[model samples]
Target: MATIPEPANATVQAVYRLHEQRDAQAGHRAHLGASLIGHPCTRYLWLTWRWAHKEAFDGRMLRLFEAGRQFEARIVAELRAIGVQVSEVDANGRQWRVNDHGGHFGGSLDGAALGLPEAPATWHVLEFKTHNAKSFADLKAKGVQAAKPMHWAQMQTYMGLTGMDRAMYIAENKDTSELYSERVAFDPVEFERLRARALQIIESPEPPPRISNDPAWWQCKTCAMHPICHGEQAPLVNCRTCAHSTPVMDGAGGWRCERHNTAIDTGRQHSGCAGHRYIPLLLERIAEKVDAWDEPGGNAAVRYRMADGAEFVNGAPPHFSSVEIRAAKHKAMLADPQVQRIKADFPDARMVA
Candidate 1:
């Protein structure tokens, strides 16, 4: 059983605060992760791949993530004690990897094991997790597939990738420190379906249809993409978020800028080029794009009319450039004479968020 954390002294509080600070500054994932691919919402997956929102966690949540990883090691030791032969590292001395889609999608296995009493001759993928007391009880009552489809999908994916027929899923109750284990059989149909979905999310230029348009839908409200998806905020400006950029056919998570005819390395993707164009769908709800025209050097000037009747142009700008539209305050600044003066006088001055 676990007890509540004791009241911290100044020194301990500083340590906790530092964890939160570090977590907040952590960068987003470069590739869509296999662990997250099991989520029900494809639009959420698409937005995440487009770098729509970077997740930040508080200190307690950060610590909980560390605890889950630590629990994996303990479970590995306990499994060995029970005569299950396990290997945490592959031939290259790394946790066995489950890779797919040219390495753009996959995750590290908790480990791989053999010699389970039920199937002593066969190998099984290992998946370890820690659940709260209530969650553990629910899992025990309903079994893994019905109780935790994400975990079930995760195991199926790992097994499918590694050519394993079975997986050993072990979960520990955080409150009671009790363990529950289940053996999962690979479902070929589900794994292929998941892989196809992942490919669709990685390659799409715009977000897939949202699971629900209603912001109040419980799932949508809790999603990280909620603000952008619901039109409360503009999508972040980056090469991946731009209409001109696309995933390269090459399996490596590489991107290409169609406007510039150049490959966009990760660094260039962060600070998108001047040619960046917002995919029209990004602003469709808040603003209807009224007109568009071609500019020199393959620039496409996009014009939009906000619901409130404010009109703005994107790239062929002596107007609001793609960068300026990112800030809600700047959206209303569109027809302001000062904006015209600034764009006219400085030619180089651009907005930053």
Candidate 2:
């Protein structure tokens, strides 16, 4: 039997639960942020932008984020004490916000600083980050460019949009209360490269390719959109990912499902129905097999090979040949030990074949 812990005061637990509930209700975002500029995988950014998968954080993680914000405020105060004039808002009385090559991509910078003897009172962007002892030490040693390229990209983008030439990068060690500050110069070449990357992500209809096929790659493991990128979590069932579904040749460019013999309206395609099936291409991309049958169709019943050369017949009585590929693949998937574990918790969690 599992050991049960003794109950403690309910007030703190209640507050944390309330925070989690509020965060969950915040809903999905529509645009990509400049903070993700240095992320290697554009597909991860695309999937997140399209809301293909959901991301969640537990109560403790949420509190950690909140604490980081508070740490920024403390850093700002310390800078002011040393005669560094920092202005968080712009001339119009709003916090400094910036964008990439196109206005469609942007993020709110931490703030901007002036009156620093190092920069001769020019308005230099201020970027603050909180880290633990180990992270803080590495950051201090390597500096922002080598230690945290994503942050470097973000600050550079901010500088490009706001027409600033430099920034004050600040880091605070949460564990030891030690601070490290560095002045980062803007690089026009790196700025253009980051902007081009953002444009590539925006113009592409399909997600960019995954960075690595291996799901266990350290970068992939820490990514927020790892499940969707690796195909571990089934993306929302849709006509785009279904083998039976295709775009109508008509000028209207509508969708249709060959199996159902019915026009698939936009609404139905966006949120797939119960009869949705997986495309063989998608299955193969996820490392699942869709082996072709070695034998020919006999008596109008087509046969297809599944994993390990297991043969399954299509067009046998009620089921049609169009769905044979998906049906066979689904059966093979369920037999896998890993999938069986998931089914233990969610008995109905079969692939939409």
Q: Quick one: best lDDT, which candidate?
A: 1
**Can you write out model 2's per-residue Cα lDDT over 49-81, one digit (the tens) per residue?**
444555788787889889989988988898899
Q: Tell me each candidate's TM-score.
A: 0.88, 0.68
- Candidate 1 off by > 4 Å: 1-9, 335-353
Candidate lDDT (C-alpha), each: 0.82, 0.68
Worst 10 residues of 2 by lDDT: 315-324
What lDDT tens digits, residue by residue, belong to model 1 across residues 1-353?
A: 99878665867677778888887655566677888888889988888888876777777788888899999988888889999899988878987976677666788899999999889998999999999998999999999999998899889889998899999999999998998999999999999999999888876777799999898999988887787888547787888788888787576777888887889888778878777778888877667788988887667898888778767778855656776777745456665567768887887777654
Supply the global lDDT for candidate 1. Answer: 0.82
Task: Report clash pairs, candidate 1.
Answer: none
Clashes of 2: 0
Each prediction's RMSD to truth: 4.4, 8.7
